[model samples]
Target: MLGERILLGPGPSLVPPEVTAAMAAPMVGHMDPDLFPVLEETARLLRQVFQTANELTLAVSGTGTAGMEATLLHMVKPGERLVVCSAGFFADRLIEIGGRIGAEVVRVEAAWGRPIDPADLERALGRLGGGRTTVAAVHVETSTGVLHPIADLARVAHAHDAAILVDAVASLGGADLPTDAWDLDACYSGSQKCLSAPPGMAPVTVHTRTRGRFRPATFYLDLEGLWTYWGAPHGYHHTVPVSLVYAMREALRLVAAEGLPARVERHRRMTRALWAGLEAMGLELLVPEPHRSPTITTVRIPAGADDAKVRTRLLREYSIEIAGGLGPLRGQIWRIGLMGYSCQPKWVLALLGALEAVLTAEGVRLPKGDAARAAAARL
Candidate 1:
């Protein structure tokens, strides 16, 4: 049997026991009467976590990328313009998906580890010059561990008369994102990250501004078709995963119980401690202080350290799991995630200790106990 790992990677953070138990409940039919209320309550709780009163809020049957596709497909028609704020790997995904859907995709890029300047977005919108464009951005770039400014970008998109779509796959419940307050037209996230559920459902919330107005090219990912099953008459578009819905609802319930504000603070606090510890151990972080993500941190691997070897040692020796970098950053950095049930001081300290031991064994020089002391001081 495989040992249970301390999931400190980019996604599918540790699931709490309550959510696991909810998934174990007896399965119900997609159109069953008992299932509708659970779906209704789940949508309601999702609205709470998303901090929006949008009536179209609900969980889609796929992962976070599914939500991205749905949002872009509905918001931007074929042959229309989509201004993407590209800074990291996921932002590139927005560009790729937009191109595949037949939209005129424009990219406004920044350094991978930095936030997008609202001025840059304004300029991109200015070049597009009017008619029905959608501005897409990533709230938290999972690849580089940078938190882009969604609220600021939203304001710029609105000023230029364009809709805004946000990829909150890494932020959502873990970070401070006010959907309605920021006037974001569409937003989506995966259940596996900050929501602490299994890796299946994608919780999406679309503002009523464009609700039921446009038909997407995709039949299955259509927002109108989805909301139809999620709300009113309760029609069936696809066979909703009853077990995954149960897990998602229970996870959202836990979010409500802890309160979003408290949960966000916990993520922030834990990340700060982790950062202090990593720096104390003579490590350099990829993203600077201002633009760093609270949920995922990117650390620069020191010279002579083997990225895959270090991560393998952590998993094999300590049963801890972290991730390596992606794309051009591969072999250059490590991605450590602090999210949901896994974002706690104990796990942060455990990782620091284990990482230090691994580095020492690999002939990397570091003073023992410095990481723990620095992290504990913050805690």
Candidate 2:
């Protein structure tokens, strides 16, 4: 029954058989000699995947949100000035977390389905008068399927002597993000979205320059403390999620085997095929082409069509699952993901074919068999 349903939603997308099997490997103590090599190898693979030489990269024992909290808590102190660029729901989360950490949060807002403008970020920095500010932005806004420009924003942040933190939760492995080349100070992501692992670990990397500024606040979420323990004499900080790490190690190994460039190209190709198919079906894309994320696409539901009804039919009839929009765009758009193992020609074709059938059954006027034909032509 579980195998019958297709996962076309935003996250917790399809996990590969190798990754799933790795999780079932015999478990050992978190600090066992056998597991240390696995931890070390996981860090090495993550660094290669993230395209960073930073020594502080490791997996936090929670979901992507935990990585966000850990990065924010360690970096921002009480009464510090923080600037956030919120283009969608997840970016708004940065502002909320900053506020909770007692930072004087200043937000630069953009409309949903659009990327944050670099000029706006520059203007906000200019207004701040070059004081110490923690600049935060989302690398990929999953809710609206928009990819924000991190390189330009990082330059604006650095010009003001600020550290830039990015939420790459939805973009990391599936998207081509060169952390060092982009000058990103800190970035965090999840295993489930692009890594094709179970949703348990959050991979985080903090540059040495950024790591020096953070003092430990909470013991467990304190990245600096974790670094000290994980790095040097190997003191025990907390019980690491052993099985999840095993799974993440396997996921990274798969990414490494595929090669980053090939993996990235695969995602781009699948996304392009998906866009072409959806466009052929007369389904409008929420984000413009330039800002669309490769891993996820949000398609606008036609006026007078019931979004929930179509989604239900897709699930019950075709055994396919795609997400509805969240927050302001709820019920107006369908969020479909082509991520990790799910980003393939077979899945793309399957989703388009099923969606075409569902939309046609609901009396929407689409060219007969257009979606499937377009996808096949692309393939």
Best by TM-score: 1
**lDDT of every model, 2 decimals:** 0.92, 0.89
Model 1 TM-score is: 0.99
Q: Which 10 consecutive residues of model 1 have the lowest summed lDDT? A: 123-132
Record all residue pairs in model 2 with backbone atoms less than 3 Å apart, i.e. clashing: none
Tens digits of per-residue lDDT for model 1, 17-77: 9999998998789999889999899999999999999999988899998988888887888
Candidate 2 local lDDT, 108-184, one digit each (tens): 88999998999998888888854568899998899999999999999988988899999999998999999999888
Q: List TM-scores for all candidates, in order.
A: 0.99, 0.97
The list of candidate 2 runs beyond 4 A from truth reads 1-4
Candidate 1, 184: how far from true, in Å?
Answer: 0.3
Residue pairs clashing in model 1 are: none
Q: What is the lDDT, from 0 to 100, of the residue 163 in candidate 1? A: 91
